[model samples]
Target chain A: MLIDQIKTIINGENVSIALFFIGMYGLCARRNILKTIISMSILQASLVLYFLSLSFHPLNVPPIGADLNAYAYVADPVPQALMITAVVVGISVTAVSLTMFVSMFHKYGTTNWNKVKKKRGEIE
Target chain B: MRRRVLAVLMCIVCFVVIIASNKVPTSDDLPIATYITKNAFAETGASNAVTATYLFYRYYDTLFEALMLLFSIIAVIYMSIHEGDKYDE
Candidate 1:
């Protein structure tokens, strides 16, 4: 009952925040470069979720009806629209970063951050 | 040992962030959302508010985002091709 009350009050934003923290934990704790990139994408997704939840209302309909008065309570579309751009940017960034990671892995033969550092030191 | 300590620290930081985020301002009272919803169809002739917002109010941003995506793809292709060439030599 208490948890339900908290859920009602916090709603989906809490879940998004939890996802953000989970991604943050992965970023900090993982040693592999690929894992870090995955965590960054997770962080981006959580941010998108947070923005999307902001656009929601309890009884709101999608903001795409011909009869405006009939759908008086439409969710805010600004955040949702902006987040689409952000999502595209996130995808591009992930793609580029993964390419870089693959290049680095090819050069050094390892994905672990510490091992890569050691390899760079040996080369230098 | 250091990883465990860092994990505990990260957990503490996350809890602080969650508590702080609880006080974020509500969006209900914002006039902008109402304005966009009310005027979207009249100005943009699009029933979908999100599409209207993207194509009308923020088309420049969309254009730049497209450019960015294209540039990043080009960079990836260029980098990979040069790396491949290096292996052949």
Candidate 2:
């Protein structure tokens, strides 16, 4: 009974909502800037999941290859396509943020946001 | 104290909103799904609707995404150069 109930309740959008809250918690609670950046990536992933889940169907086929036998439907292509771009952008953003973090760490010798903020304040 | 409590409150608020909104889609897919599924083939000539959508419909965005990856990689390489000042490992 419990498993069936849980299965009914648990789906893509719901899971994404949960992940979004987890990412939000990470963003709000983490002291390390690196963790904060990772939280942002988590947030992006949750958004992607949310969009993909919007058109989710059990009997739906993939949006690939137009020619196919009788199928109920294909999932929305727009969300999948956009989410691909989102993933790419998210990777680049994470990469750029990491590089920036390394530079900051080297200069300041700390990765904690409070310490970095204090140090930056002292300097400028 | 305040931050932790606020975080918990935010979590509670988020859960409440989601439960209250009840906006999750459960029935048939939206109109865009049907339109794209049917017409994507005729319009793009690409078999894969997703490929057609990204590669044909919005190639510019894909190009920029590629550029962003390239620039970010270059920046990482350039910034991580050995500076002869040893710090923490």
lDDT of 1 by residue, A1-124 (tens): 9999877767678778888888888887889898899999999999999989875778988888655656658788789878989999999999999999988877889989988988879644
DockQ of prediction 1:
0.65
Clash counts for all predictions: 0, 0
lDDT of 2 by residue, A1-124 (tens): 9999889888888888889998998888779898899899999999999999887778888877766334676777888888999998888889888988988988999989888988889644
| Residue pairs clashing, model 1 | none
lDDT per residue for candidate 2 within B1-89, as digits (tens), equals: 78978997897799769956977546674676677677778887888888887898778978888988898898887777766746613
In model 2 chain B, the worst 10-residue window by lDDT is B80-89
Error of 2 at A80 (Å): 0.7
True lDDT of residue B77, candidate 1? 86
Model 1 lDDT tens row, B1-89: 79967986986787677767788677566577788888888887888888988888889988999999999999788666644365543
Error of 1 at A41 (Å): 0.5
Going through the candidates in order, their DockQ values are 0.65, 0.56
